[model samples]
Target: MHSQQQGWAEQQDALAEFGQFALSCIDLDLILQRACELVARGLQTPIAKIMQTIPESDELLIRAAVGLPRDIATTGVTKVPGGHGSAAGYTLVEGEPIVSHIPTETRFQVSEVVRRADVVVSANVVIGATGEAFGTLEVDSLAERTFTQADISFLQNYANLLAAALDRHKAHRERVANAEERSILLRELQHRTQNDLAIITSMLRMEARRAKRSETRRRLESVGHRVEALSLVYRRLYVTGVTDAVNLSAYLDELVKRRFLMHGLEHDDAVKLDLHLTPVEVDHSQAVAVGLIVNELVTNCLKYAFPLRQGTVTVTLERVEPGKARLTVADDGIGMPDDQVRGHGIGLELTPVLAKMASGDFTLEQRDAGTAGHLVFYIPDLRGGGSKPL
Candidate 1:
């Protein structure tokens, strides 16, 4: 008799191992099925069933079962009462564990479907972290058998593990959803950037065509170059997976390389561009304004300043203080004439306008050399976070 009992206990331990392995390998449905199987075998019962709460629904649905016919067990929906009864629903509602040893009728509003079970024993164990009702584990014996506290404790622990697994699945699903949303937003932003570039190109082409003279055409072509520089900044931003703002130094270097320097100025008389930039980030509007301002300054240096000669056009950017920045464009070329200085020319007029857009000031002056010109401007920092380098 002692040897036989020891063998049976070993078999029960093996069944527990199988239950754990099955729960690990299978989905929620299979976990429930495996739970029913384990409980039925451990309790030496003829039938076992697991019931779960339907989200937003007051009814408890039979999720899994063993031994009993599925068709008979789930013939109808079972409405669980709010409190104080022997039914699984009532046990869950009252936040308590319950067990029944015999096929006893309880006024817990258990459906007629469950009334058909001749031998029934059930235990309700709260599984979730918040002590919320996760489900019910039930074992039915055709013969009378004692239900122990150890059995209830085992079922409760397994149910808790099952709840954690379900929560992990839910979190993963939400992460996937959030990733999909970000992908959609990025695609939309790319589409809008392309549209903006196309429009700017069209505008530049029209403006260039309407110019009556070669000089005017040249100037408008320079404007088109500026627009393209701005477009390149956005393109790099899109490629780098950044959409908010851009680093000024890197943007300026890229702009100069792509736009003006591509012309390959060989002679000392030809305009040579240089940059001295401080790390900074600017919003889209300020970036555009800065891009256009640089375009105008560089174009003017190549046109009027050098006057058919080579020259060095230096563009320097430095952070002056917490919220202010200094930008200076110095060209070693013929200084501005007194007559031309009054109106400040169209490009020079744009300098002040761009500076105002940045909420700052602008200045134009002739260097002490008497042959070179300098334009200094200040603009407010838009990025309140940390400074960035392009």
Candidate 2:
């Protein structure tokens, strides 16, 4: 009686240990091997192994095993045909546990490895959460033994734990795949939107050339330029393959160079361009507002700053502090008249509105030989969490 009580106590301890293994966050293979090891020790078995079904195939492949020959454990014995021919295969197809005393059992052909290893008794149970079986867990003993219902129940419980783990892993993989798919779709949508904007800009340019009156032509041209500026932002986004933030240095360089080429000033010997920019990243909305403001300021300088188009325009962007950045566009030419400086030209009128949209301050001042436009704004740390101005 005392010996039976001691055996019962040991089984309880093994049950607790096995429960911990089931809840562990270890990799699937390691978990399976560890579970097999625990079960072998608990049941006093000489060998334990797990076999998984190959998807779309009628084969049971050994995945993890304990107390088995290295060659058989690693290379895995020949794939067991999925049916009632082998104990593991039968359990998988029937979705039920099987116990056999090899000496007396003739229902299934025993594996050559089991015969060679002198395995006299074996038990196998299906392993999976859903109704369909994924594999089977098995334990074998060298001496002929009768596996009671209680022993079979213990193996079934272990298989159930393994099934739950497989289910959780499948769910995690699906979630990750879905997120990646969504990102690709968003990028494609942004690319198409950029292409559409380019089409509209081209149409507007054609309309401007057909306008009869000089004022009407100028208005159309101005509107077209604004659209072109907006289109450039999306172009950069598509080119860089970055949907979240714009690299300000590269963006401004491209923007200014394009403007120079458009205004027929790229080859003008009288006009010189200088850019002193620092690398910074900003959200899409802020970048668009900044680009538009730059468009207006640079256009104003080309038209009015230099009376004979014979001076230099300098654009600079730099970090002012941890949470601030400043952009300056300065030119050496005839300064704006004090009265006209306050007037509502499209360039001047739009500058302040765009600056406000960008959460920035806009200012214009007369320099020694021309006019200077300055815009200071809060820039967020794009690397960290959402906008924390830095």
Candidate 3:
């Protein structure tokens, strides 16, 4: 009784260990091989095999084996004929457990693999899959021994565990495949959007060049700048492959570089960008809005602030509080000028609208020497598990 109880305890421990293995492993062959080792050791059988059903044939493939001859073990291409000829094949085809004691085992003809292994007793159990039999997990002993009801029960339960593991691994693979497909689609969409925006900006500039009115040209160029600002965010997103949030500091840094390149102001003698930006992350809407606002403010600075064409437009980002950030653009030139500070032009007039879109507000104040503008907006909880994140 004690021996039987000890065997039962070992089987239970094997099942628990197998559960952990199955959870972490997606490799089917490795899983089957491990299961063979466990079952063989648990049942005190020295030789074991896992043979899978061959499609539309009376044959089984030896997918994995332990404590068996090197020739009998699978190299991904070992097969045994089915239909009561071998224990593994019979169990797989019949979809049940079977035990054959060699002395009186007329139910099976000794196959070449088994014949060489010198098996005196064999126990085979079916490993199942979704709505069908997957294969057979069998154990063979060189010394004749009877597998008790409890022993057979342990084998059947282990087979059940294998069935569950196989299905779970299949599901995991499908999920990974689906995630990759989505990522590909996102990249394609971003590429097309960048191309579309490029065409739109080119057309606007072309129309501006042909216009008779200076105001008309300026307004068209302004619209093009806004579109260009929005487009840059998408371009950055495409390059980074980020789906949920955009890094604010990196985007702003790139924006300054872009502005310089667009108007041939990249030379050190021209208006330079003095960026002291702190890293922040926000959703798509805020990122786009923030980009546009920065472009407009900086454009106004370049258009009016510096008369000598040699000054710095300082852009700073600060985290004032949790879930809130402040972006400021300042210049030592002639100030924001005109009705821009009181909310007019593309920069000021749209400030309120854009700020609301970002779940925030905007303010402007003239310093002793230069003008400073601020847009305080919500920074998403990228860390999650909160209504808002710093």
Best by TM-score: 3
Pairs of residues at least 3 apart in sequence or in different chains that clash in candidate 1:
250-390, 268-310, 269-309, 269-310, 270-310
Global lDDT of each model? 0.64, 0.79, 0.82
lDDT of 2 by residue, 1-390 (tens): 896567556656776786676566546667777778877876778898888888888768888888888755463455666666677877766667888888777777776666766788999998884357778889999886888787888788778877776777677668778966875886788789888888888888899899999888888887878888888888877766677788877788888888887888875568999999998888888999999988888887777777787888899999999888999998888877665478468777888889988889999888678888899999867886332222
Q: Give the TM-score of candidate 1.
A: 0.53
TM for every model, in the order presented, reads: 0.53, 0.72, 0.88
RMSD of each: 10.7, 5.6, 3.4
Of the two candidates 1 and 2, the one with more favorable lDDT, higher being better, is: 2
Cα lDDT for residue 24, candidate 2: 63
Best by lDDT: 3
Q: What's the candidate order when arranged by decreasing lDDT? A: 3, 2, 1
Global lDDT of model 1: 0.64
lDDT (Cα, 0-100) at 59 in candidate 2: 69
In candidate 3, how many Å is residue 60 off? 2.9
lDDT of 1 by residue, 1-390 (tens): 895576457546745665566546535666667667766665566777776767786667777788766657651244433344336666676665666544564546544445566555555666575356566665666666665666666666656656765676567668879977885797578667866986897788798899899888877776677668667766766666555567766777667655555455643525676778787777656776776777666666665676656667787888777766777667777855665455457766667778667556666667753233233434445456342433
Question: Per-residue lDDT for 30-118 in model 3, tens only?
Answer: 99889888888788889878878877888888888888778665546878888778887767656678988865677777677887888
